[model samples]
Target: MGTITQFHLAFPVRDLDEARHFYGEVIGCPQGRSDTSYQDFDFFGHHLVAHISGEGRPLQSGRFDGEAVPIPHFGMNLDRASWEALATRLKAAMVAFHEEPHLRLKGKPGQHVTMFLFDPSGNALEFKSFDDPEQTFIP
Candidate 1:
């Protein structure tokens, strides 16, 4: 594998203060640059900008491995230890889970653990871990 590059994503949010609290305090992302219209966060080594739009759309669900998962979500693929730690932190923060953390595709290739949740702005996020990291991109 070659060098991995960081990703940048800009999404709309209703309030900047709420975004800061959720991403900074609850999710544990370090705050970066910011202004009246937007705020940046170090989201799991990726660039995440929350722009003030004062509105957000409802999330739709999609089928995945016999489970309903929130569509148009964004998240990181972590190791099992980190994934579990984050899950515990989120639970302690009282954040509701869109899909509880659980294993999927048992005894099969690409089997992994996954969980889903939403931000204060209603943007869905997923965090998962693969049994075999090498199988991440395997079909």
Candidate 2:
């Protein structure tokens, strides 16, 4: 197999401490170096940094596969079991889901499990997993 690369993402947050709780505790992201202004998180295998962008940010949505998806959302792909565990955690936390968890492309080439939710900062995130990992890139 070829080398896999991790990506870095920096997004807005209303409060640093709240961001810390959401990303660190809620989402299970391990906390990294942080200052008063920004903090980095281990987002599954990616680098995610949250910056204090103040309050009352607008949320946008788009349609995908007949479902309303959060515009400009970020997330990761996991195996089925990991995805379910995270889903349970999010539900136990009473995290408000923009779109409840469901299956998409059912009985098709790219069938998968997906769910969407937002952080306290209002940034959207979608976590999904495919029945067959190899179908991920299929058209």
Candidate 3:
């Protein structure tokens, strides 16, 4: 069997402290390393670093998939149960979302349930799950 390796991703945040509170306190990702300009978080089984984008300014986002999705975003590929749990967690946090968690492309071959969120930096991230996991790579 093949193994999916953990990965690392970084994005811009307006305030490092806010990112710390969101990712560390709210989202509950463990802290990795940090400095005055940036902080690293253990996101699921991956690493996410939030860095200051120069001056204190809100991060910009883009529209995609019928929503104002953040352009520079990243997230993990989670299983069905974990994906549902994360959606519950996000709702409990009262996190303002760009797109709510829902089944996308109903009746389609790659039908999936996906949710979009933003970090403290306004960077978009998505966590998705498929009813048939093996269909993830179906062409």
lDDT by residue for model 3 over 1-139, one digit each (tens)? 1233334355778888899899989999887546665676777767566767657565454332344445356776577778888898889999987779888757866467888877897667877776765544343
C-alpha TM-score for every candidate: 0.58, 0.58, 0.52
Candidate 2 lDDT over 1-139, as tens digits, reads 1222344455667788999999889999887656565676877767566766555474254344666555567776677877888899899999888878899978877688889888989877878777876555443
lDDT of every model, 2 decimals: 0.72, 0.71, 0.68
CA-RMSD of model 2 = 12.0
Which candidate number maximizes lDDT?
1
Model 1 CA lDDT for position 115? 83
Model 1 spans > 4 angstroms off? 1-59
- lDDT, residue 128, model 3: 72
Write model 1 residue lDDT over 1-139, tens digit each, in one string: 1223334455667788999999999999988656666676877777566766645653354345666555556776677778888889999999999888899978977688888888999988877777876555343
